[model samples]
Target: MFAEEFVVVDATSPLWNAARPFLDIALRIEQQDDSYLWHGWNKASIDAFLQKLPPHCSLMLGVWQVDAAQEQETLWLGCICEVVDGAVCSLRTFVALEDSRLPAIAQLEPGYIHAQELIRVTKGQVAPVAWALFTDKTTWDEWLLAADADGQPTDKGEALAALARQGRCVLLGSQVTHHPHHH
Candidate 1:
C-alpha cells in the first residue's frame, strides 16, 4: 500500500512561511512515502484525490513493500508535483539511495533523466525538476542562474532583482498570489 501526506506552507502560517509551496509538497511526499512503506503497504494513490484538493494543500504519494533487508528500505514508486511559473506538473521518480548523500535513482535512471530534460525543454525554464533535493544556502543563487539560463529571467541583474523582491519564491503546489511582504 502507498502512504500519503499533505503539507502546506500557507502564506499565513509561521511554521513553513519561508518555504516555497512546491518544496513543501516534495518534502511531505518524501516523508509520507518513507513512513507508509515501512508499515507494509504495496499500493498508493494520489492523482485522483489531488486533483480535487485545495490549491493550498501540497500532496506527496509514495509506495513500497518489505524486502530481504527486512527493514523496508526498498521503494517501488514515488512522484511529486513540479511547479513552473505557477503551473503544476508531475514528475515520476524512484529512490536509488538514501542517507549520507541522499542520492536518488534519478541520477542513474534514463527515464527520469529524459523526463527532466523534457520538462526543461518544454517549460522553457532552466530550473531543474528536482531542485528541492539540492536545497541549501546556495539554492537561491543556483536557481537564479538556472532561471537566467532557462530564459525565465532576462539577465543576472534582473534575476537578482526578482529574487530580492520575492525572497524565496516557489511556483508549484499551492497558490500564493501575494508575496509574504505584500501581505
Candidate 2:
C-alpha cells in the first residue's frame, strides 16, 4: 500500500479550473440556489501518483466519490486514485472546461514537496475548496514588486516573499531569504 492521498491540484497543475462545476462531473452550469455540482479529472494529481509507483507493478485505478459544499456549489469532484499493494498511492483529478484558456496555477512542475502539500491542504476537501486562486502574470508581477524600486524587500515584501516561499511563485528565487528592511 502506498498510503498516499489526494492533492488539491495546486495552482501550477494544468488541471485547475476557475469556473464553477470546475471538475468534470455532471451538474448545472447555472444554479438557482446559487449552487452547482461538478465532477472532473485533475491530471496533475495522476501524474504525481504515477511517479511513485513501483516499476512493473500492477496499478488499480478507480473513482473516489467526494460530495460536499464549496462556495456556491454543492459539488462532486470525480477523483481517481491508484491502488498499489492494496493501499492508495496517489489521487489525481479531472476537469473539463468550455473556454480555450484553461486555468493557471504556480506549479507547472509538481515536485514531491509540492504534491505532499497539496494533499495536506486539499485532501478530503471538495469542489471550490480544492480549487486555488488564479495567479496570472500581472498579479504575480505585483506580488513580486512588493519590494522597493531598488528591489529590496519591505514589510509587504516579506509577506509576498513568504507566499513565494510557500510555492506561490519562483520570481523571488535567490532573494527569498534576503533580509527585509526594518526600522
Candidate 3:
C-alpha cells in the first residue's frame, strides 16, 4: 500500500483528457440543479486551480458514483486538493464546462451504501474532498459503522466493507437474520 504515490496535473498533463466524458452529465445536472456542481468542469478552472494551488495538495481525477449519483450514474470528478487551517483537504469548488468538455462512466449500485463509501477510499480512508479554492470554508468528513484495530471499517454501509475485510460472517442474538459482527 506504500510504495510511491502521487498525481500530477497541470496544463501539460494528460489528465485534461479525463474531463471529456463527464462534461454532458455534469452540465445537465448542474443546470437542472445549481446545487450539484458550479462552473461545471473544464480547463479554465483546472488551470486557475492549478495556478493558485500549493505544493502539498493535489487534483484527483477519479470516477465516483457517490450518494448524489442516481442508480448506477457515475461521474468523473475533478477534485482540487488544497490546504486550509493547516490541514490538506478538498476545496468543494464545482467547475462547469462550457459545451465541449466531459468525462466517462461506471457504476457502484444504489441499494448498497458500502460501495459508495469504500470505493474511493484506500485502507478505509480518503483525502478530504475539496474542489474550490479555500481560504477559510469547511466541510465535514464521514466515518463508517464498525471499526477494526487497524482503524479500517470492519462492518458498515451494509455488510460489504465488513465481509470483504474479514471474509466470514458471524451472527449473534435473536433479531434480524443478518447482523454486523463477523470474524
| Residue-by-residue lDDT tens digits, candidate 1, 1-183 | 122332222233221223344344544554564333211211133333334444322222232222456633333333344433333443323221123333443332223343333333323322233221211234343542343223221343234345545543322222223446542
Candidate 2 global TM-score: 0.19
Can you tell me which runs of candidate 3 are displaced by over 4 Å? 1-54, 59-63, 66-71, 76-78, 84-86, 93-100, 104-146, 149-183
Checking candidate 1 for backbone clashes, the offending pairs are 1-41, 1-42, 1-43, 2-43, 96-105, 126-150
Which residue segments of model 1 deviate by more than 4 Å?
1-48, 56-58, 68-72, 82-88, 94-183
The local lDDT score (0 to 100) that residue 171 gets in candidate 2 is 30
Q: Considering TM-score, which of the candidate structures 2 and 3 is the better prediction for this target? A: 3
| Model 3: lDDT to the true structure | 0.30
Candidate 1: residue 51 lDDT (0-100): 40
Please state the error at residue 149 of candidate 3 in Å: 6.5
Alpha-carbon RMSD, each predicted model: 17.5, 17.9, 17.2
* Least well predicted 10-residue stretch by lDDT in candidate 1: 37-46
Winner by lDDT: 1
lDDT of 3 at 69: 45
Comparing candidate 1 with candidate 3, which one achieves the higher lDDT?
1
